[model samples]
Target: MYLDDPNRKLLEIDTDTRQGPVIFRWLTLGMEYLIGVILVALIVSVSCNVVGRALFNNSLPWADELARMLFVWLVFIGAAAAFSRYEHIAVDALVRRLPLRIAHMLYLLQHLIITGLMVVMIWGGYQVLSRSSGRSAIMDVPLSFISLSLVLCVIFIAVVSIWRMWVSLNVIRHPEREH
Candidate 1:
């Protein structure tokens, strides 16, 4: 459902339009909330570390370690959430100039690339997770904990890419059947 604007540029698909099955919508919302929570934790950890050093001339090593871990999770989860919302960068100027069918083909190709990369990342993450037997120096948390974030988010991204490919295929097959 596109909102018509007389002055608007042609072929600008509204990415803000959230359309997906209930589970995906839930996952997107949950990931967004997770990102917010992680950000707050990251801020708090860094702030405490700063205050400890500035006010007491002592810094907690755990705070720094926690902050780093939170930052890693934030980045990976944020990426997945952004991908869910179609918030990633794209060269839409060129795609907009093409026929709708051709554009769908391009979208399909893009998603296919993403899916392939995600698969590779998933395998790599698994390898790292399996191989790493070490723990954080200060926190004593398993190093695999950090690598799991990559595996989880990449899995989500891959699923979203597959979903996008399916949508593009449908559009290419039955343009008139689009809602």
Candidate 2:
């Protein structure tokens, strides 16, 4: 299940400094900053590589590799940010059709399931990170560093999902109050 209103702003989670949790406010800000930096870096690296190849007849091999690594970070980190904001793709038609109380129950269930999946992913990522020893050909960065992104992403998602579930429960308990 997803949030009911598709027209609502995707990143409109309770990030207000005055009314929202301080930790979540900082987390959202940090993730936004990081994603912006990663996007700019990805763009610059790809552009430089393309220009070098076209104009100089030589390419920066490291540029391709760096771009790839940056892309990995971008996707995972972006997913975490999206998760925090409940912006991921989801089909909420059935939930939206149900009574508000039942719909919120479904939302709580969905969040718990997501939290479970993220926990499993974090565990699997840890396993892979421990076993991975290879380095990127150009950057010489350990493979574990790349695998760590999965762990980081899931950690953040798990936190957000759990928080959402808590909020959903509160809403369920106090249907008259706006959460």
Best by lDDT: 1
Model 2: per-residue Cα lDDT at residue 53: 95
User: Considering only N, C-alpha and C atoms within 3 Å, which residue pairs clash in candidate 2?
Assistant: none
- Which stretches of candidate 1 lie above 4 Å from their native place? 1-18
lDDT tens digits, residue span 1-179, model 1: 64332111222223345557556778888988899899999999999999999999999899999999999999999998888766677556777667767778888898899999999999999999999999999999999999999999999999878877877787789767743
TM-score of each: 0.89, 0.87
Model 2's lDDT to the true fold? 0.79
TM-score of 1: 0.89
Per-candidate Cα RMSD to the true structure, in Å, reads 4.0, 3.4
The whole-model C-alpha lDDT of candidate 1 against the native structure comes to 0.80
**Per-residue lDDT of model 2, residues 1-179, tens digit only:** 74445322222365653334568767877888999999999999999999999999999999999999999999998888787766688886676677666677787888899989998998899899889999999889998988888899999888877877777787679867756
Location of the lowest summed lDDT over 10 successive residues in candidate 1? 4-13
Give me the runs in candidate 2 sitting further than 4 Å from their true place.
1-12, 16-20
